[model samples]
Target chain A: MNERDALRALAADLPHAGDDAAVVDDTVITTDMLHERTDFPPGTSRYTAGWRAVGASLSDVAAMGAAATAAVVAVYADADFDEADLDRFVAGAVDVCDAVDAAYVGGDLDTHAEFTTASTAIGTLTDAGPVTRSGAAPGDALCVTGEWGRSAAALRLFDRGRDDAAADADAIGTVDASNGAVERANELFRFTPRVADGLALAPHATAMMDSSDGLARSLHQLGEASEVGFELDRDTLPVHPAVEAVTDDPAERFELAAHFGEDFELVCTVPESAVDRVASDCPGTLVRVGSAVAAEDGITVDGDPLPDRGYTHGTE
Target chain B: MNERDALRALAADLPHAGDDAAVVDDTVITTDMLHERTDFPPGTSRYTAGWRAVGASLSDVAAMGAAATAAVVAVYADADFDEADLDRFVAGAVDVCDAVDAAYVGGDLDTHAEFTTASTAIGTLTDAGPVTRSGAAPGDALCVTGEWGRSAAALRLFDRGRDDAAADADAIGTVDASNGAVERANELFRFTPRVADGLALAPHATAMMDSSDGLARSLHQLGEASEVGFELDRDTLPVHPAVEAVTDDPAERFELAAHFGEDFELVCTVPESAVDRVASDCPGTLVRVGSAVAAEDGITVDGDPLPDRGYTHGTE
Candidate 1:
C-alpha cells in the first residue's frame, strides 16, 4: 500500500488526522519526513536541504492559520557524513526559524545509511480559532498566496545541470548560465513559509491549507474536506518568473505552476465580501484565483476538469 | 564528530537545548530518530520497533515531568515493505500513546532504503513547574524509578538467538529453553515509559531526567547538568530479573544493570525530607540508590569511581 492508504488505515486511530497539523487546545503541531534520494537533487546543498525540509513542516503550521512558535528537526545521516555539512544544515534550519520569528529548538540525531530528516513544528492560535479545511462554504472566494512554479523551475535546472555534468566533467553549465543557475536553484528551493499571512488570514478565511501538493491537488483536497467545488480562472493564477525562464509554452508554464508541488503558498477560501479585506491585511501577496461552488458543480479551471495530480510518496 | 559533539555545537544556536525536551511556555516538546541498523535487531518485530521508537520520545516528555498530550511518528521504509508490518507498527504506536493517556496524532510517511522512524511528542506542565535536570541540590536524594538492564538483557537474548539460528537450521533454541526466551525478550524490550511516575515525582523532585542511557551515565549527566556529585550505593541498585537470568556472574549483572542502556526509567533527585514521601507517592517502583553531594566529591559507587559508559549513538 502507498502512503495515502497507510494514512487512511491510521486515521481510524487518529481523531485529529485530517488537518495539516493536529490542533490540541490552542496549539498546532505537525511533522514531515524527507529523504535524500527523493527530496534533494545531485547538486543541492546541505543548507538548502535543511531549509526545505524544516520549511515543509513550518508550512503545515501556516496552513493552520497559527503563529509559528518553534520547530525541531531530527537528522539521520551516515556515520561518515561531513561535519561541515551538518553545521551548514543547522545554520539553515536556524535561519528559517528566525525568518518566521520561531525558535529553532534542539532535536535528536542518529546514524543511518542515507541522509534523512524529520521536522516537527509548533504554532499557536491567534485571537481567532484555526481556519480548518472543513470550514469552506459555497460562494467563498478561492485565493492563493504569492506565485507558484519556483520549485518546479529549480528541478528543471537541476536536471539540466546533471545532464551537462554527464556530458562533460567541467561543462557544468548553468541553466540560464548568465544568472548562475545552481545558485538560483538553491534560492528557489529555500522558501519562507507564509506564517504571517496565515495569521492575518485566520480572522477572515473560511477554510485554508497550504499548496505543497500542487494547486490542483490542494483544491481537490479542500473540496473533499469542505464538501465544496471550485471554479478557478486560469488567467488569474500567478506563474513565477522562474517558470517563464524555464519554458516558453504557456501550457507548460501553467502545468508547472498548477500541478508541480512545493510552492509552499497558502490556498484558502474566503467570503467574497471579506476577500478585499484579507488581501489588504495579509503581509504577503494574496491573489483571488477562483470561487467555491456547490459540490455538484465539480472542480474546474477554465470550465475544464482539473487533473488530481501532484507530488506523492511511495508507489501508488 | 559524534552525536554528542554535534549536539554541543548546535547548543550555541539553541538556547533551550540541553534539556530532554524543550519547554515552551507550559508545553514540553521533543523529537527522536531511530534507524533499523543502529536501533532494531534482526528479529525485532515491526510492532516493537514502533512502540520503542515512539516510547523514546514519550520518555523525554516524562523526564520533563509533564503530561503527555500527543505524539506523531514519521515512518520511512522501503517501498516494498509489507502492509501487515505497517499496520502492526501503527497499532503499536497507537497503543503506546493510549497507555500514557496521550493521543496518537497523525504523521508523514516516505520511502527510504532502510526502515527508519522519527517521532515527536508533546506534553504540558502540571500545576507545579517543569522539573529540569539543572535543579538538583547537594542534599537531594538521587533516585531511580523501576529496575534497570531490562533492555540490556533483551539485547543479550537477541544476540544469543542470532547465534543459535546460525549454529543449526531450525535450532533457534530459547535463552532459558523452558521460558520462551525470544518472547520474553520482546516483552522485556517493551518497557512502559515512566510517565505516571514522573508526574507523581514532579511536585516533590528537585531535578528529573530519564535513564535511557543507563543509570551510571544518567548520574553523570545529572551531575554535569546540576553541577553536583553523586555517591551511589552499589548494593542499592535494583537489577531486573531479566538481567540476572542472562548472567550468573555478579560483575556481569552489575555491568549490564549499571552500564547498559534503554531501560527508559526515571532518574530524579528529591529532597532528603521528601524521599520517603516520593517513594510512596510514585506509581512505580522507586529506588533510592544514591545522594547528591558537593561537586568536589566526585561520583562514585561502593567507594569506587563508576565508569560513565552507556548506549551512545555514533562513534565517540
Candidate 2:
C-alpha cells in the first residue's frame, strides 16, 4: 500500500480519519509536508517555498470552512543550507500568516540531508460548523471558487521564454506588479486557500473539498465519501485565460482545468436553492460547474469519462 | 542564527510564540521533526522511530501538563523505502498513542530522498492552566521527576560492546518483565514523556519545563524566562546507576546527568510549603536537587558554573 493507504488502514477506526482536518472540540488541525525536490521548482524563491508550505496546510483548514488561528512550522535543511534562504522562508511564512490574520507560532527546526518543510495549521469552526466531503447529496449543485489552470499555464510559460505573456495572462488583474505573471502564478501555485469563501459557503455547502489534488480527484473523493457521482459541464469549467493563451486546443485547456492540482480552490456541492446565494456571498468569482448524481451514474464530464490523473505524491 | 533564533526573530510579534506549544483556548499544539540521519541511530527499529517521533512532540505537551488528545504525523521517505518499515513505523506510532491515552489521528505521507518524520501533538489543558517556564520565582524548591543519565549511558553502552550493561542499569524496575535490562534501556532510549508527573505537579508547579534538552540547558531556559537562577546540589543530582556503570569518573557521570538530553523528565519549581506535597503526589521518584535563586546569582551546580552542553538539533 502507498503512504495514504497505509495511514488510512491504520486509522480506519479513528474518528475524523479521512476529513481534511481532524476536529477535536471546536478546533480543526491539519498538516502538510513539502519536499524541496518534489514541491519546489528550480527557480522557486525561498519566500515562496515558506508561503507555499504554510499555505498548503492552511488550505486544508479552509477546505473545512474553519477559521485558521495559528500555524506551527518545522523545517529541515542540509548542514550547508544558506542562512539568507532561511530568512526569506521565514519572511514568507510570517507574511502569509499576516495575510490570513493568523499567528506564526513557534516550531522545531533540524538538519537533514535535503530541505523539507512540515507545517500544521490550527483553526476553529464557525457557528455553522464544518463542511465535510461526505455531506453532499444527490442533485446538489457543484461549484468551484475562482479560476483554474493558471498554475499549469504558468508552468508552461516558464518552460517557454514568454515571461511577459505568462505574467500578463495569469494576472489577478494587477498591472505594474513587480513580479511577472509566471512568478505570480508560481506564487499562487498553491494559491490562497478559500478561507473566506469557505466560511461564507459553510452554511450552504452540502459537501466541500479543496482542489489541491485537482478537480477530478477531489470530485472523485467527494463522490466516494458522499456515495454520489458528479456530472460536469465542460463549458462551465472556468479555465483561466492564461490556460487559453498557453494551449492551442480548447479540450486541452479544459483538461488542464480538470486535472491540474494546487489551484487551492474550494470545490463544493451546495443545495440547488442556495447555489446563487453562496456564489453571491463568496468574496471571489464562483462558477457553477455541474451537479451531483446517483452513485451508479459515476463521474463524467459532458457525458464522457473523466480520468483521475491529478498529482498523487510519491507516484509523481 | 539557528532555527530557534530565526523563528523567534520572525514571530516576536505573536503572542505565546516562544512557549513549548502554542495555546489556543484549552488546547495545546506542538510539533517536532525527526530525521533519520540525525535522530535515528544505526539499528534503530522502525517501531522505535515512530514512537520517538511522536513521543518527542508529546513531551512538549507533557511539559505543560496537558492531556494529550491526538496526534497528526507527516512521513517523508524515499520512493523505495521498505513497506514493512512503514508498517512498523505506523504500528509504533499507534502503540505510543495508546500508551498515552491519545488517538493516533490520520496524517500525510509523501516520498522524499531521505526518511523524515514530523509529528504534531494536540492536547487539552487540565484544571490547572499551563505551567510555563516563566512562572518560577526566587526561592522555589527546584525539583525533577525521575532520574537522569540513562539515555547517555545507553549511548555509551551502545557505543561499546556492552549493550547488556547499558540496558541493565537503565531498566525501569523489571519487577515482572521478560525483556533484559539492556533491552529495557533500548526501549527507554526515547523514553516515555512525563505526562502523569507533569499533571500531578501542574497545580503546584511555579515553573515547569522538560529535560529534553538536558538539565543544565533547561535550568538556564527557566532562569532566563523566570528571571531566576538555579543552584543545583551535585550530591542531590539523581544520576542513574547506568551512568555510574558506564563511566568511572565522578565528575564525568555528573556531567552526563546534567548535560545528557532526551531523558524526557520534568524539571519544575515548587514553593517550599508545597514541596513535600508535590513530591508525594508524583507518580515517580521526585528528587529535590536545588532551589531557584535571584537572577543576579546566575545558574550553578555546587557553586560551580554549569555549562549548556545538551543535545541540540542541526548540530549533528
| Highest-scoring model, TM-score | 1
| Candidate 1 structure quality by residue, lDDT tens digits, B1-316 | 6888777665555777778899888888999887777677666777888889889999999999999998999988887876787878888888888889988887777777778889999999998879999999898998999988899899888787767665766555423323355566777888898899999999999999998788889989999989999999998999999898899999999998998888889999999999999899888999999899998888999878988898875432
Q: Model 1 compared with the native: what TM-score? A: 0.95
Mind giving the per-residue lDDT tens digits that candidate 2 earns over B7-111?
565456657667777787778889988777667654456788788889888888888988888888888877676667677787888878887788787777777
After aligning candidate 2 to the native by TM-score, how far in Å is the CA of B147 from where it should be?
1.7
| CA error at residue A8 for candidate 1, angstroms | 2.1
lDDT of 1 at A264: 93
lDDT of each: 0.86, 0.80
Instruction: Report how far residue A251 has shifted in candidate 1, in Å.
Output: 0.4
lDDT of 1 by residue, A255-306 (tens): 9999988889999999999999999999899999999999999999999999
At residue B193, candidate 1 shows an lDDT of 82
